[model samples]
Target: MIGGFFDRYCGDWSPDEQALFEALLEEQDVDIMAWAIGTQPVPERFAGDMMIKLQRLDYLPIDR
Candidate 1:
């Protein structure tokens, strides 16, 4: 489900956001949940803006 959202919106994402999307796909659900909720440290490569993009997903406009 998350992967679907990423693919759907990612055409407009920055390169770093794209990278983080792929990285998230490679992770387990628990880890992804922790990262999304700020309970664990996001990997250095996926920190900062990448995490910010994901955390702000609720604000993303959906066509449907």
Candidate 2:
């Protein structure tokens, strides 16, 4: 899931978005998954357009 997210969005990300993603990488995998799946509330620091896109999960393959 994370790989799909990175592949789809990382190419055009700004430096700040890149940094935010890097910081997200440091979080627990479960927390990231929860946030992406809308099972957990995203923290204020991580709440924004990027996170909103992540929550959409639209980049994922349809077959999956």
Candidate 3:
């Protein structure tokens, strides 16, 4: 549910923008990782779909 909101805003965003959002929102870990892809620091369990979604939507950052 919350991830939906995050991904929703990630649409049409640049890689840098996406990274910013994720970094800013990655304060806590999520339990619903069924659709998740990958984590920045790499969480114990991450949703692969989430990573692809962010990358596809250009929500992920390039280098920072």
Candidate 4:
């Protein structure tokens, strides 16, 4: 799910965004779900802006 979005839209994001998305992909599913649901903290590095971007996916206008 997230990986598909990354592949579709990551080219428009900065290098750091791309890296952060890849890092998220490498994580365990439970941790990812926790972050997605706000039950666990997202890493401080990708905290504010990046987290917002990822969480906004459902609301975004995805072309693919």
Candidate number achieving the greatest lDDT relative to the actual structure = 2
- Model 2 lDDT per residue over 4-57, tens place: 999999999999999999999999999999999989999999999999999998
Q: Which whole-number lDDT from 0 to 100 does residue 28 have in model 3?
A: 53
lDDT by residue (1-64, candidate 3, tens digit) is: 4455475766766797667556646555452333343334444333344455544535544575
Q: lDDT by residue for model 4 over 1-64, one digit each (tens)?
A: 5665666677788887778777877889888767767889888865877677666667345677
Q: Where does model 1 exceed 4 Å of error?
A: 4-8, 14-16, 59-64
How accurate locally is residue 18 in candidate 3, as Cα lDDT from 0 to 100?
65
Q: Report how far off residue 51 is in candidate 2 (Å).
A: 0.6
Query: What's the lDDT for residue 59 in model 4?
Result: 39
Which one is best on TM-score? 2
Q: Residue pairs in steric clash, candidate 4?
A: none
Order by TM-score, highest first: 2, 4, 1, 3
RMSD of 2: 1.2
lDDT of each: 0.73, 0.95, 0.50, 0.72
Clashing pairs in 1: none
* Residue-by-residue lDDT tens digits, candidate 1, 1-64: 4765676577788886777788778889888778777889888876786577576667456788
User: Candidates' TM-scores?
Assistant: 0.64, 0.93, 0.32, 0.65
lDDT of 3 at 12: 68
